[model samples]
Target: MMKKIILHGATNCGSSNFGDFLYGVAVYNYIKENYKDIEVGFYNPSEYFIKYIGDCKISLSKSDMLIYIPGGYFGQSHKSRFIDNAIQFVRFMPVGIKAIFKSIKIGVIGIGAGPIISPFLKYPIKMIGNKAEMISTRDNESYNALKSLGLDNILELSDLILALNIHNLSDTTDQVVDICKKCEGRKLLFVHYNHSLLARDIFARQLDTFVEENPEYQLVVGSDCLLSYDDEYYIEFSKRVKKNCIQFNYDSPFELIALLERVDAVLTCKLHVGVVATMLNKPVVCFAEHPEKTKRYYRQINQPDRCVSLYDTSEEEMLSILKDKIFEKSFVPDEEIDKAKRNFDVLNELINKK
Candidate 1:
């Protein structure tokens, strides 16, 4: 039977993070390949609020089904603001209830929990989970978190971006490729977000020290999120290094994947950046803001030693880990990719069930 499916996540948002954008791509591609006859519509969560509550030209209607893409946004709070929490509750609760009323099958994929400072958010999230026909969490911590709230049917699936077929994707532009391949076998990619300014600076100093110590390798900065704070930190880090670090504007996920192929290893604080590197079979040293989420992902791919806690681990420890672990060759097994693909099967089964 054909259905009008409304896929929701951080899609088509101007300020969306690249990692989130990749999740959208993965979900969209999977859906298009599987459900060719279904009418699919996209909704950005940020924009959903604007259209739902504010005066907007576009509006969201009750659909036959709703699929929320996989991402670590369940417990991610911005400033831990009460008003923000209130708005989120109001924004999602009504839709979730409406979905139930309309018998709209709801699915949430590759979502994680934690850093949820507010107790108020627990009920709303639980409500959505209870209403969902299928909930595929990306990591165990997320599964545990959601299970702790009495939601027991969640599947502990890995991140969906791992299922993306990057092997067939086109390479980046010649200019970008040339810049990325400057040092050939000695190119290392660095990616980080601006959640903590102090941590960002600490990484910058460490990167400078690493560059000075290892003159053979060239550091290349990759932007995962297009935030002003991150851009400013990149500039600051480049200046402090006193070396020419090549920075590339990855406007799309394919370009970033191409750049990853050109680099030897990845050192990143962002979750998806590290995941993508591992997908490309490159060694990655991850600085995890939420240790649970990163550890969960690493555990899935059988690389538990790759995740380092930003709070507990020092810069020297991270650099040491990079030297000991990240430089070594790593292989992403075919079984791992198959495991991620199984998540899509779970999604399809839930959606197409009688």
Candidate 2:
């Protein structure tokens, strides 16, 4: 029987991304509810695990399992530098290795992988995938990529964020509620863009045209990331767009969801913003810089057209697509959510074993 488990993910290291934070919370909450007797601790190797690797090993040795919670950790993104990704890999590698050495079960769940161009990144991830007791990816691309790498222990599951019980979240903050109240009559299009200046300028132009043509909709420019640059990007975007836009800054995932609930639709470059909006049954259009994960997610839900290339799609085309998608009916199928919940099944089975 499992007595202790340490949760590891980007969120454990105080990541400002709301989606990462939510992933950590969702996994933690699920374990607390389902594995009531198991002791849970967060292992944030990114911070000091390298410097204190010996101590970390000792701590992890006591644990029965180590769960690598959901996010796109296995791949490279334009948003992050190669060195940053390398550092992340380095930090987690020793932890996983030591856990294996101690016979501690390691599970990598609801992870998104691939577009792993560099052998440097690919090989280490392959090592982890092979060593992991069970590895479940959230997207088809991830599952197939790992499979091609000769890892046979992987399963394709939907994103863990889909399994969230959004209804249990606290009430919308007064500030967000007030903002929604102020824009009462206008259909709010929630907008979050990546930090690329070129992408921002292109998106701004498209949105300007969109609002110019459709005056009934107003833009709510904000971020799913609390990183300073993300805030700066939206603030800059608001200035570039011709239409008046509301700049939103949220402190927690709950606040972000609250704002999402108030919005009519979502247009974002960030993956999880679109994912969360889809979960809320809000129509979403994504400008994917790295399209693999986003495109796979949309395809999984039978809404492939909603995911579009950030760089290749022209302003006119983007404007047209945005107009079409923003008001379109969208819903996450019950089966998809059921599939997402299977992300935890491997761990559940291990915990229940005699």
TM-scores, all candidates, are 0.86, 0.89
Off by over 4 Å in 2: 45-58, 78-85
Residue-level lDDT of model 1, residues 149-261, one tens digit each, is 88967887667776777766535777566785576666565545445665566667777777777777787775765555656677887787677777766555566677787
lDDT for model 2 comes to 0.77
Once superposed on the true structure, which residue ranges of model 1 sit more than 4 Å away at CA?
12-15, 45-62, 76-94, 115-117, 184-186, 191-196, 229-231, 333-335
Candidate 2 C-alpha lDDT tens digits along 1-354: 788888777744545667777787677767778878987767753333223122332157778888888888788765567787777676556677677778777888888888776666788777777778788889788998888888987888888888878757645888787788778699988877755577678779888888888898888877665555766777678888967888787556677888988789888887888888898899999888767677888999999889888877787787778888888967898888998989878667656755
Cα shift from native, residue 71, model 1 (Å): 1.0
C-alpha lDDT of all candidate models, in order = 0.68, 0.77
Candidate 1 global TM-score: 0.86
Candidate 2 lands at a TM-score of 0.89
